[model samples]
Target: MLMMFWQLTIDANDPARLARFWGQVLGYQPAPPESDTTWWAHYRGRLGGRDAFDDRIFDPDGRKPPLWFQEVPESKAGKNRLHLDLYPTARDDSLPYDRRVEIVDAKVAELVELGANVRRRERGDSYYFVVMHDPEGNEFCVS
Candidate 1:
């Protein structure tokens, strides 16, 4: 695939709800409408009903690619062929193993409050991570 300026696209049953959850998790903001700064309102107005828009969110600091959530008819099935890994402590290599575990666990708790459910905790020879499912059951990891 062509790579420049690409955004990650997510399929969701309820695109707006999923987008809200991810926006909070990633500290992202919704893309504003061209004619209005009121976010969802303009989209809703244009569509004249619900299912207003395909949700888009961008990293506030402009470091990461934007996320675009599209409405899909089917539910998730089987394991994800690809997933996201979140580093709560910003992937610090100098940190102790136990310290990294603590940081990851703390971040997991925060995520749980935001609608993520932990599947399991995993420990490897050199790393620790938590497998989690989003509110809509998409799998991702915290480390």
Candidate 2:
């Protein structure tokens, strides 16, 4: 038998706060027994008997994956060799590249208000993605 994946762990200077941010973004609800310094929250989902953190798991009509935040001391430094890529499920694949960029621009702005910062941008003839840092400077992408 193979072991199952239990969670996706994110390192944060402020685990509680970061967890809350991700919980909202992903629609996860706070797990029970929370205190002034709790580090875990559980989102409801199922994937082969394992819980998967999807997009929404809180609202009565929402559902998504499980996201867990852990505390860390130092701030993220240099570049993240690995990062998450988020794609809009409703995007039109036939849209022009420039138009897609425009759509992502609006999303980037919204994320900025939520404490994400644009780190870098790269474009190619066929594709492009932006590197962004979360409130604690962890890297992620929009493509």
Candidate 3:
């Protein structure tokens, strides 16, 4: 059988709020309200309303995998084994290296204004990327 990829789920103290943060960061939107309502009902029924928190953000173009946040009591304690790498350029591969760097730096600054913290920046002979943490400390890269 062929394998299928679905959503990427993350643990958060506040699923809805975290989802909103990631939604803005990725230019995504809340998974359609009808879809979310159905899922929420199912979750609440299955869990007896005890641990029924779930929120999802979807790419506006329906291309990228949806991101899910589920409420959890425990906090993130360490770095992520897997992290997202974002390319802020809008399919503009023809941009010069310096311009690409400028775009990336501008995006990093914008994300910082939206509550992300810059961890570090890596500059190579041919490329550069910035490591940053989300509001809840999840590390992601921007290039």
Candidate 4:
């Protein structure tokens, strides 16, 4: 049997810019083309301008899935159905709730300075997370 690796593709108004922003947020970097033909050309017949890439980023530590941002002219209109939850403390059970909260807050502040906005914070029995919108208005959480 064979396994196929997958990449999370994101639609973006400014693909390269969004990729850079996410790179800063996740400590990821631009990923090189995986193959000599890293593009798909089928759309060229119907959508001539479509390219295989807008931008792509990958975790240097190889711990997270690669992200590929594709350019789209349409602006985001509704809330995203899928989103990411970032665990700043690496999801360590030993970290106290307060400590995790503090770390999450710090990360939120940093992201804000880099062009993200907080939507709100949520509390649970033993959890705390801040829902935020990325520079391109994609929703995600930090905890």
- Estimated TM-score for each candidate: 0.79, 0.67, 0.77, 0.79
Q: How many backbone clashes does candidate 3 have?
A: 0
CA lDDT of every candidate: 0.80, 0.62, 0.79, 0.79
Over 1-143, each residue of candidate 3 has an lDDT whose tens digit, in order, gives 74365679899888887887888888877643334444434434654444333387777665567778988999999889989889987647688889989999999999998889999999987778999999999999998
Order of all candidates by lDDT, from best down to worst? 1, 4, 3, 2
Worst 10 residues of 3 by lDDT: 31-40
Q: Which ten residues in a row have the lowest lDDT in candidate 4?
A: 37-46
Off by over 4 Å in 1: 1-3, 32-54
- Backbone clashes in candidate 2 total 9
RMSD of each: 5.1, 8.2, 4.6, 5.2
lDDT of 1 at 71: 86
lDDT (Cα, tens digit) per residue for candidate 4, span 42-94: 21232345433348776665556778888899999899999998888899879
Clashing residue pairs, candidate 4?
Answer: none
Better model by lDDT: candidate 1 vs candidate 4: 1
Name the candidate that leads on lDDT. 1
Pairs with backbone N, CA or C atoms under 3 Å apart (clashes), candidate 2? 52-65, 52-66, 53-65, 53-66, 54-64, 54-65, 55-64, 56-63, 56-64
Q: For candidate 2, write residues 1-143 as lDDT tens digits.
A: 74343446666678767766666555566542233211223222222344433322232222333455666678777777766776642356798988888877777787788788999988888677788888888888887
In candidate 3, how many Å is residue 94 off?
4.1
